[model samples]
Target: MSLSLEKILSEIEQLTPEEQLTVMGYLVELVKKHLTQAQPKHKWSDLKGMAPYPLLSEDAQEWVSRTRREADEHRERLLQGEE
Candidate 1:
């Protein structure tokens, strides 16, 4: 819903001390909601290789490849158990 400054001022004036606090809380929540909603959605795959600096060493790269291959083979073996 669209809000006008006059409407907001009138609403503020109508609020009790406790209600005013609630209104402030609600406004903060509203700002957070809108901000997060406006932001673009992303995925790990979408940002793959986008790092400003490389975070892996040559040994770490080798370990990652070996671990991934082992995990794939283990997954296949587990699937074979199901069959």
Candidate 2:
């Protein structure tokens, strides 16, 4: 373990049970937010030619359009009470 982590753990050990729980919850949320913000937000151009398969840009666009249309149709059917 790193020195910083060790010091934090030692300090946490001195806290009362309720305070410890609060600190633990805060740390959990902090770590979660940090990890979420660390994720890469790639643009379409960034991933343009990175697919393993031989898929063209037009092919990808078509797939997206078809998928969205299907989803919309499904949602409409559901909304109309037609499972």
Candidate 3:
């Protein structure tokens, strides 16, 4: 280790037990904050090209309506014990 680090370590060793624990806890929190801030922050535009036009073989609005209708029909069948 470097001389400066060795000196600092010696100083830390001379502290009371409670002070050492406090320093350790502070260092842990510092590392946690750094890691949390290092992650990327995404925006709506980030997903702009994730799904291209039409998204599927059919029109997006038409596909959504068709799926909703099918779900309602399936629910009715189940409700009437017709499944």
Candidate 4:
């Protein structure tokens, strides 16, 4: 709609596939930079009590055990080349 955008689009259309991909990657990085600058940073204490349920020590232990078991199984499967 804007003249600048129209000009950019016309130029992009003329680029080779690889050049277009490079321009797209550059644009993605620019968008990520703008987004990070616009967002606010949070401290760990500020996120306290954010969970719906209270997290107890036992709950944490159980979670660690389950994750470890799953990871070990995954590694075993990978070593065996199992699909």
Please state the error at residue 53 of candidate 2 in Å. Answer: 10
Q: lDDT, candidate 3, residue 83?
A: 39
Candidate 3 clash total?
A: 0
Q: List clashing residue pairs in candidate 2.
A: none
Give TM-scores for every candidate, taking all chains together and pairing residue i with residue i. Answer: 0.42, 0.47, 0.60, 0.50
What tens digits encode model 2's per-residue C-alpha lDDT throughout 9-37?
99999999999999989999999999999
Q: lDDT values of the candidates?
A: 0.87, 0.89, 0.92, 0.91
* Arranged by TM-score, best first: 3, 4, 2, 1
Question: Between prediction 2 and prediction 3, which has the larger lDDT?
Answer: 3
Output the number of the TM-score-best candidate.
Answer: 3
Prediction-by-prediction clash tally: 0, 0, 0, 0
Range of the 10 consecutive residues with the lowest summed lDDT in candidate 4: 51-60
lDDT of 4 by residue, 1-83 (tens): 99999999999999999999999999999999999999989899998888755375357678899999999999999989965
Model 4's C-alpha root-mean-square deviation from the true structure amounts to 10.3
The better-scoring model by lDDT among 3 and 4 is: 3
lDDT of 3 at 22: 93
For candidate 4, the lDDT comes to 0.91
Q: What's the alpha carbon RMSD for model 1?
A: 9.8
Candidate 4: segments with Cα more than 4 A from true spot: 44-83
